[model samples]
Target chain A: MVDDEELTPLHPNHVKVLRVVTALATLPFVIVALVLEVRAFLFPGAFMVPVVLAALYVVLRIPLRRYHARGYQMGEDRLRVVKGLLFRSDTVVPFGRVQHIDVDQGPLERAYGLATLTVHTAGTHNASVTLPGLANETAMEMREAIRAHIRRDTM
Target chain B: MDSTAPTPQRTNPLGMIALAAQGLGKSALPLVAAMFGLRDEFSGIALVLVALAGVGGIMAVLAFLRWHRLTYVVGAEDIRVESGIISRAARSVPYERIQDVSLEQTLLPRLLGLVEVRFETGAGGKDELKLAYLTAEEGARLREVIRERREEEAVAGVAQEAGAEQDSPPIFAMGPGRLLRFGLFEFSLAAVAVMGGLAQQFDFILPFDIWDWEHWMELVAGPGDWIAHLGPWAQALGIMLALASLAVLGFATGIIRTFTREWGFRLDRTPKGFRRQRGLFTRTDVVMPAHRVQAVQVGTRFLRRRFGWHSLKFVSLAQDAGKASHVVAPFAKLAEIDPIIRAAGFEPESDTLDWHRAAPEYRTDSMVLVGGFFVLLALGLGIFVNPLLGFAPVALGMALVLGEQVSWQFLLHATDARQLYSRRGWLVPKSTIASRVKLHSAEISQGPLAQRRGYATLLLGLAGGTLALRGLPVERARALRAAVVESMTGTDFSELR
Candidate 1:
């Protein structure tokens, strides 16, 4: 049932880079808040600095942990992905229906030895499974395995 | 590879000129209209600019003869088109994968004795894959070549044989009478504006022409003036005149529509499948075969329902040409639809309704939610506006929500041919049918509300259209999915492939 050892682990910094980039991309919101804080200081009791800071910090914290850190298993019959926190989701996409698999890497991800694997199915909904924070080699392997399984089942 | 393959690769250059004109014509009228409202100082400059543009346009037209370079080749395998200037584009479409081939001829093309050819393929999208402006004769030859190639593929057992031609599908030939009907149907919108403008411009159509405008104002100010101030006889006469004028205007609009749209409409069944040829100034021929089709939809608006009329269209896998994929059946009786369906190799649904056996513990949560929306609307109105108006909306919302739930009459049934059918469409009704072999996937989803109500929605993925059964008994959704999987895996419909 399990052949776990042969499966390659993703690069260690992959998740960290994703989290940091996501947090940094949202730096504009932080800057805006700081500007608003300055405005509130000049005109006291007018702006809610603490509330805005708390909300931004909370939003940043969630992505910082969740964005880069995730694990996936592309089984013969189903694709398993465990993701999210507070409202965690575990999805099982059966192999019979999956149409194709795509592996994509952005410039930032390239620096982190990571690739995003997306599994596409036929329908309008989330057609396939997406497993981020995967090593390039592992992504290719998973893609081939998933492709073989889908083709076998559909054919 | 064929020893007898034709060597002459002929295409109509005249048609190319016509194509350019058609593209130019779309923006021409607006450009001409824009010329009217320029400032005095700019008017002289605009005229000079227009003159320069005219000269440049003439020169461009001359250059077009040299620049409009296209080569079309009829090979044994497929049709190939090579066109473009600096960056050349060459596209070849296999006969087997072609959804349809259409011929279009605009006013210029008609005058120039040319026709534009359009090919619809498996990869349908917004952009057409193949287009060439060819002489009318060349267009006909291309059509023949493609049709013959498709036939050959069928004969060679590479493609599915077209089902036997059924009764000819109902054709809505736009005569003057039908045009009048179409015009009347759209009278409130375009027709009214046209009539209002004409009456305002001319003084002869109405008895008092300008007085009609005064009457219109008076009627708007107080409709009572039309009935009470005017004598009963005069009021009656005025009402009759208005009705007559509306009819005449409707007829005129219909004539325009008929001329512009279905000037020379024709639908016929060929050996390959169904063909629709239309257009007055620009003729278009579209062809759809039996096997390539995904789903069939029969629909009617409230106005059309009284005539026992229905429109037919097919859902195809092709992504391009959303409108082309939707073939419009101008007018068809409910009884005479089998022929159209059979021609496309799909068995029509049984006249008797196939009631759904939803899961045992189905919930009315969606219905409740719909009702809740009405309640919220009422509450909002009560808070923001008149309390009495709130009740009216609440009552109306309840009626509407209740009607929606009742109208969601979904049924999932299996055909003797091993095809699964799910028909669900309430307001604008549609039926989604799929062969088990063509079933790509099935999804069963339950939202928080749906879960509480023991209800779920099942989406059946097929080649043609997506079949969705909402608020189904969750168990039933699963069962249906399992059944589809079983049928698909148990027996192969690869023979159709």
Candidate 2:
């Protein structure tokens, strides 16, 4: 396994994507906090301060931490992906073992010109490994590289 | 066998009789109960017989319709099956994609000289194609045709020779005497549990509530009074007799089940692969190619290990029934198993290979986490409930901690150039050996506590099964991952033996 410092970081625009996704997720809790405030349940700041603080922590602080936590290494014939803070998973998928490859872009990711690359294998466990937060062009290049490797070996 | 005209054909017409018989058997009990309930209204035994015949006639007609609707076509490139009466559905499986073909025969089918042909596509479960109640000769011919087509597609230039029927002698088999001994180790109490459940389900038919202790005591009062007068020694003897009977029942059940399942168990090495045939009532014949095997497992119970008895299984892409692994040798010594393992292109672990135990900190962390939970539980019980009850939880917690320690001692893993071997558990130890080249991917995962403790788990992805080495120091986990990845990437899987 490569050290954390050696891994190449994801495109910087991924941080903005993460922030927008987090904000959207926190919208429900923010609505609940407002409803409680309007109904005057308990002290005025009881739920409001905690909800705002939590939402700010998730929206502002988490994206950067998560961005820093995720990294990937493209070797000659294998791809290594490492991510997560509390529950880290480091995976290696050999180019020859990849059954298929997919490059996907969600609405937010498309806006930021980012994509997610997924590698599928035949194994029942960990059959598919997805590495999110990549430049769309870079994702396409990696997919082509893997596809070429498979084609050369099969031939 | 080469008649690939693509003509749709139905299975043996006699299959309708077997199907109708099966349907009637399923509804026989309910039908009889209904007949008795309406006996007074009809006022004659002849009327009840007429109703029974009517139901059986309906079932026979339905069976005929089902048989008529189902048809299969053996085509040049693929085998197509079109079924359903109201809305037609057709499925075509290419010959190159079919992994293997198997044959099965139940009592009725066997009596009718028919067999069920199955085309396994390595997809597992109901996805496999099944053609039931084909004539035994047709079934055998179909299996050979599909196998020949698959081989021709696999290797385009090489022409396979015909009539290569000199199969190797039985690699492993169980005789009656050996099966009897195996049954002794398989003593189970499941039969008693099923009987108890059935009794509970029909307790309303009993005069009194069987669950009531007072009712039981009342029923046993006469015998109980006599036994009491016979003194304490006699009462102890009675209790001993009751326990002895339970043990006898358990042994009897185990022996009957073992005899039925392993009556003609035989494994042979054919040119295509390992051919296995077994069962007393519902015989099954399955052939698995040697190269399709992804891993091998050797398992033994605590007591069985002492007697030098172990079981061997092969993990393959094609499912055996619904299970991912097929038992090759259910009961055998290590010496008997070694040859089979070699035949499957795997070797037993060598003594020179390095073995590594899980990190000590991993054990300590779990003990602290689990022990803390028990301590909280004990305190809650002691403060609000009886203090004596709290002591029980404390003792249980100590026992659990000790169990974790014992298990941790047995948890270890090793890797050679060709295979990764992992052994876990003390009571029912299972050793898994997976081919490194066959592994799809490698992963090192860590939970929050593990991240803080500097330990991680390594998971090697295998088709149809799992092979994981848990609780290793970060450095060791990384080393294992690198080793596995090296083997996985270094080889061209298309050329693997």
Candidate 3:
């Protein structure tokens, strides 16, 4: 799914948060296997070993790949977000159609000094295009520029 | 902030009852399920009352919080709403960006002297920022304020561009008599499908259930082995005849609903935009401003096509009575539809347009997309049940593939400087005319195979929804995309907003 043009990649540290989230997701399966082993069921190693490998593969490989795959660009009057590795999609949001903008930071994101900038548009398809794993300062600048552009466009 | 006027006021307290009543109705099923499982049939009535009270009380509290949290502030250049009970989100809609402020009143709300205000900002799906409980006067005042703001913007726009103002007069009216005629041809496959599904689910409850599948299956089991008394061809014929009759029955009921919904249908063109007043009992009114219109579509179903009748709908920034689009002239001659499209700012093209056909590859793509379903179904039925049934399906699938090929021959799309034109579909051909200025966005996509074939599907998203022109050469799609984007670059959307 590689394209001719190289896009602006996401922040490198995003893979760390994604890894943690995916690790927590696989915790239940590991717990179930541990319980089964303690109960003297057919050795949990049989299922747990493969499950751990799969979970580890998913957590370690997928996040870094996805992080590298995600990218966004600020066009003259429209915002372009291109993402996905296998099923790639390119979304364009014209400045005229934008209703609002939001900069969001979760606890994990805040700790990393990263934020996600979302551009809200009127179109049903691609209603809100989010540019994730941005430096907090860059996110603020983008948010301000979007608001200023909206004001200028209205005038 | 404006204490003198109190712009944002609570709705009539009676609206709380209406809210509670709606909540109670929604919760009644679950409450009954609980009582039924408890096996206390005698205490059902008491349980229902208690449950209803619980629902009502919860709704009343939520409604009060919602009302308390909701407030509209009309600023000089913007209108701001501070809403969400817990989240406390603030949304500021610039004055020029607000598309339409829709006012609605249902029976209960109307009786309670309360109305709902929906602020639409041209976002297609769920465009509403709704305040469900507003006093009737407050709703009217809010609408008036927005109207005045729009007028000021329009006046300023007119100063820049002269002769920019236009109005649509009453072009079509469907009286009670015409509604009856309209209902007769309202029969669609969707109606049959819905009725068929409902009958399948609830047939056992009916006293006289002619559609009882179990009884029909038992009767069709046939004397001795299957197909002993009746031949396979005869059995097939019987099934076909029964299906045709069921379709006819469904259409009959669909006609009734059509009559009820469009009894008082009326369409008129005002200086500002197109207005539709319809519905027999509810009497809904919708106004679509001329500038706000996104695209105009002229459609004809198979039945209506035979009669040279067409329906015209407009995709506009304003929500059309919370529907996808507004049906300006539901059932009319092409002569009638032409003028309506013209009013939406397009010179109506001739019926025999020199359309640009899709690439020849579309025939194969469509066959795989559509005929593959029939082929798979046939294979499943043949392998799982009867081998003879398999041959019929293969033939049918081949026939479907043939149909797709024919449809592909007719699949076309073209664009001029002012507008984009596309005529698609085999069974129910729909011609769409979208103003280049109203173009929302464009997308070009190709599968791995299609990329190799050098063809892709180009989707032009307008106010009217996406118009997909499939099987265009990759170069053509890219060129078309560039052209559309160029046209959309500096297009002023003040009107649509």
Candidate 4:
């Protein structure tokens, strides 16, 4: 069970696109800040270019490191997750508690051979985790394993 | 078969007429009010109002027709209601699927000697069925007939269980005193309704009212003497006013809640499930299988905390809508809960040792980041534009956010079996639940800032919904996740160290 590699690395391009989308979301805020800075320059006042740059750097760097380090291991008993930038974390989801599973991909993910897995549990709405940016074939295989576990455990 | 026995037969035509009137009020009141407000417009406004009145009258006629059209034929396995005028629809509710049966008698129905029966199904609001305008006696007899059938099933179940372990009976009956006590004590809904009514009458914050300072002062001070001058009388008046308001509010609320929740209230044991009945104007009957209870929550509010009363709520799929199938027993001091727990077929007491409190990781960080951002905006405005805006407002807002953040605390407990209990809340605390079977997914999330703080959040998904626990100790959250996954698949699992 420990040796079973249910999760395979996601496509690098998919990981890149995810980070790009995140950075693009912050673009409007950056534009607003830049406009404010230009206004401040004309008026000889305080500007926030340094803060904006620092935020952009942090946003791109974290996901890059996380994608590089991220991996998942599936056993008959639990679904294990290994992910983190500096502080690593491993999450396990057992078959008995998993209410259902969702496999999803956005247009970007589809272009890059990546998919995400979402699991649900009963007591806490937040029990399940989504392992985004998984290789498409690996995500399909993992989905099958989770489904098989659900059928056997439910009986 | 009970078919040979004589059955009472009577219907309330007047009550049926009233139901039609109520149905019309629901559909036509807005139209009537709109036309009334436009009465001064082109003489066509009068024609509009007349048209609306005619429509409302037609609705009343239709409602009565529908009421007369409804007919229920109870079979050994199910009860079917065949009604609906143009597109005739039939609702066939199997006995097993019924969550509860309520016999409700509104003020009008009570006067007319009629009761409205409501059949609450396991699913959402759309599944519920209603049969109105039956005589009260007929309603009671029908309820008894259902109860007797359930009892026979219970006896059969007990005999089977007795063959195995000689266990006690599965059902417990509440005494009349207990019912009355439950009715008197559960009154939060009533308190809220009264507060809403008072807020509407005195809209002090309305810009128009704020401008009418003289009118407010006159109303407050009355004709001559200022309000403060009547010292002792003022104090007495204040006390009496508060009590009178609460009493009227409580009475109105208690009666309504009791009518819906305790009307024809019955607790029955059956071979397949447990049943509860309650309602006033429209009774709701409910049932749920014992094995399907995913989680149990025993909750007490500030009011009930003093009296040690608890309301037991079940996380069951069958009855997932409205109030679900809950037992609100007042005076449920620790001793009373044991039987209720047993009745639920689950051990009442938690098995795990009270582990260390799991503090939320993002509590301080989130409050500081979000509060700091807002404070920065305010400070920027103050520095660049208006010094009059002052640091005091921002300071107060930051303090409030920090105060709330500091109070967030989570406790995690695990049973010898796969059961895990996680409860966290501040101000109005709530219990976080996860059963072994309901966990569909879990993820440990962190961004640039959260990673630095050595924290992550776990997102859990349940049958009806999802919740995200943010700013949790990453290591502990990981360990908890592993335990949940292990229990779920029945495999030996280790923490993600």
Highest lDDT scorer? 2
Better of 1 and 2 by lDDT: 2
User: How many angstroms is residue B258 displaced in model 4 relative to the true structure, after the best TM-score fit?
Assistant: 5.3
- Model no. 2, DockQ: 0.68
What ranking emerges by TM-score with the best candidate at the front? 2, 1, 3, 4
Q: Provide the lDDT at B112 for model 2.
A: 89
DockQ score of the complex predicted as candidate 3: 0.10
Off by over 4 Å in 2: A1-5, A41-46, A152-155, B1-5, B25-48, B156-167, B206-228
DockQ of 1: 0.17
User: Which of candidates 3 and 4 reaches a greater DockQ?
Assistant: 4
Q: How far off is model 3, as Cα RMSD?
A: 8.7
What lDDT does model 2 reach? Answer: 0.88
Q: For residues B1-497, could you state the per-residue lDDT of candidate 4 as single tens digits? A: 25334332224566667676677668666666666676776258565857576667777788777766666676666677788777778778877556556666566666677777766664556668867778877776665565545556433445433122113343444555666666676554556666677767777766566446798778767853564687888868878998887876776676557556555555555543565545555444455656555566666676655676656666654443354435533235657656666665566555444543534556767677768777887888799889867576687777768675655544344434545555554433444344554455556767777788777766654444444555667676676655555555553111100
Models sorted by lDDT, best on top: 2, 3, 1, 4
Local distance difference test, candidate 3 = 0.72
TM of chain B vs. native, candidate 2: 0.91
lDDT of 2 at B286: 88
Q: Which structure is stronger by DockQ: 1 or 2? A: 2
Each candidate structure's TM-score, on Cα atoms with residue i matched to residue i, is: 0.72, 0.92, 0.67, 0.63
Tens digit per residue, CA lDDT, model 4, A10-104:
56765587677878777777777778878775543344656577667867776677677877776655676767765555556665556678899
Chain A TM-score for each of the predictions: 0.67, 0.91, 0.86, 0.70
> Top DockQ: which candidate number?
2
**Model 3 C-alpha lDDT per residue in residues B1-497, reported as the tens digit of each score:** 34235365454567667777667667777666655655564465676676556567777797777667777677776777787889988878776666767666676776777877777776545545667777877776676677667778665554323123224336787777677677778765676678779988987877766666777677656552466466888778878998998777767766778876776677766655666766644445566778767778888888778878788888764566567778888888888778778877776876555578877775677788677788888889899999889888788888888988888876888887877888888778888887776776565666666766668777665654666778887677777766776677576444455
For model 1, what is the error of residue B237's alpha carbon versus the real structure, in angstroms, after optimal superposition?
Answer: 3.3
Candidate 1 CAPRI-style tier: incorrect
Go through the candidates in order and give each one's DockQ: 0.17, 0.68, 0.10, 0.26
* Model 4 spans > 4 angstroms off: A1-7, A19-63, A77-92, A95-105, A116-131, A149-155, B1-19, B30-57, B64-123, B127-266, B318-331, B350-354, B359-414, B422-476, B491-497
